[model samples]
Target: MCRWLAYLGEPLRPSTIVLDANNSIVAQSLDSSLGAETVNGDGFGFGWYPTDAPAGTEPALFHSTEPAWNDQNLRELTRAILSPLFFTHVRAAAAPPIQQTNCHPFRYENWMFMHNGAIGGWHKVKRDLTLAIDPSLYPNVLGTTDSEVLFHLALTLGLADDPVAAVGRAIRTVESVGHEHDVQFPWQGTIAVSDGQRVWAFRYSSQGRTRSLFHSADVPTLREMYPDAERLRLFGDEAHLVVSEPLSEMPGVWVEVPESTAAILEPGGYRHEPFLAD
Candidate 1:
């Protein structure tokens, strides 16, 4: 398993969420309270859209095989960059080699993606699944992690056309292929994807017992609840975060995304919709 955080809303330094929160992404990397694995030390990656970059500009990426907590560069870089939307992932390699290419927060065009779980029986289904990716898109598949394959698989199925539907279709296909290989539980993960604007976070597994996933309470709601909390004041009302675990233990600050569902976060607000695998 892995841990990741997706942020959208105000233009702020990446370090604010990646490092400043009580149980920030950096903290989660070393001491994850809700992850299946306590320490996600394989590698880490960060992807962020430039605040001043022109429209359609792809997000910048920084990946390292070094552990998040042990990397001085990661700390220096996160504090220096500011972005309206960004993704940071601390990986726990299941079977893939711990190389920079296998880091999370994979990118394509103007989109960025990261995942926090695994594809069950990946070895049994790897060949078939890899062959299923559209050849035109397959060349872009640079890493060997099942997480990266899942991204391209979604792309082949039409992620650009419709994120939710494409990912659902991809998972459906993975399970179908898994069943053919006699794998009982074929899919298990929470996914976060962005196209330089809105973000879509998903919670699903073929068996209906997905990993832990949560999103911050709406900014206005958090404001009313904690009027004096200086941290809440730093963010604009539209600020939102979809994380593998609550960034902080503050009461009423986080809400668990229901099993088999998706949350779409855009400028004005966000909405939750059922995410079905079938």
Candidate 2:
């Protein structure tokens, strides 16, 4: 299992969430209270779209095999950059070896992706799933983790045209391939994807149970609820976050994404839609 977060809305420093929050992503990497594994020390990755970059510019990436809390460079970089949308992931290796290529927030052109779950029976279904990726897109598959493969699989299945549909199809493919190998619950995870503008987050599994996933309450709502809290003053009304777990214990500040749902965050705000995996 892993822990990750996606942010959209106002332009702000990535460090505000990745490093500075009460239970920041970096803190989660070291001691996650809600993650399946408390220590996600395999590696970490951060991807962000520059605040004022030209349209279609791909998000910048920084990956390290070192644990997030132990990486000095990660500290320096996150503190230096500001982005309107960004992704940060802290990983805990299940079966794959820890390496930079295996880190999350994998990128393709203007799109970025990260995941916080696994494809059950990865070793049994790895070959079939890898071969199923479109031949043209297969060339871009750079890591051995199921996370990166799933990202390319989503791309091959048409993520660019319709991300929710593409991801649902990708999970179905994984489930079908897994069942062929006698793996009953083949998919388990929460996923986040972005095209440098909007963000799409999904929480689902082949089985009924899925990992924890939540999004921040609307900024205006938070402001009204915690009017005297100084931290609420840092964000614009449009600011939003989709994370594997709450970044803070503040009441009414995070909303749990319902099971089998896709949460989409765009310019106006965010909305939830049923995610059909079949």
TM-score of every model? 0.98, 0.98
Tell me the deviation in Å of residue 107 in model 1: 0.7
Question: For residue 12, what is the lDDT in candidate 2?
Answer: 91
Clashing pairs for model 2 are none
Best by lDDT: 2
| Per-residue lDDT of model 2, residues 1-278, tens digit only | 89999999889988888889999999999999989999999999999999977768899899999999999999898888878999999999998899889998999999999999999999999999999999998889888999999999999999999999999999999999999999999999999999998999999998979999999989998888888999888888899999999999998999999999999999999999999744
Where does model 1 exceed 4 Å of error? Answer: none
lDDT of 2: 0.93
- The count of residue-pair clashes in candidate 1 stands at 0
Give candidate 1's TM-score: 0.98
lDDT of each: 0.92, 0.93
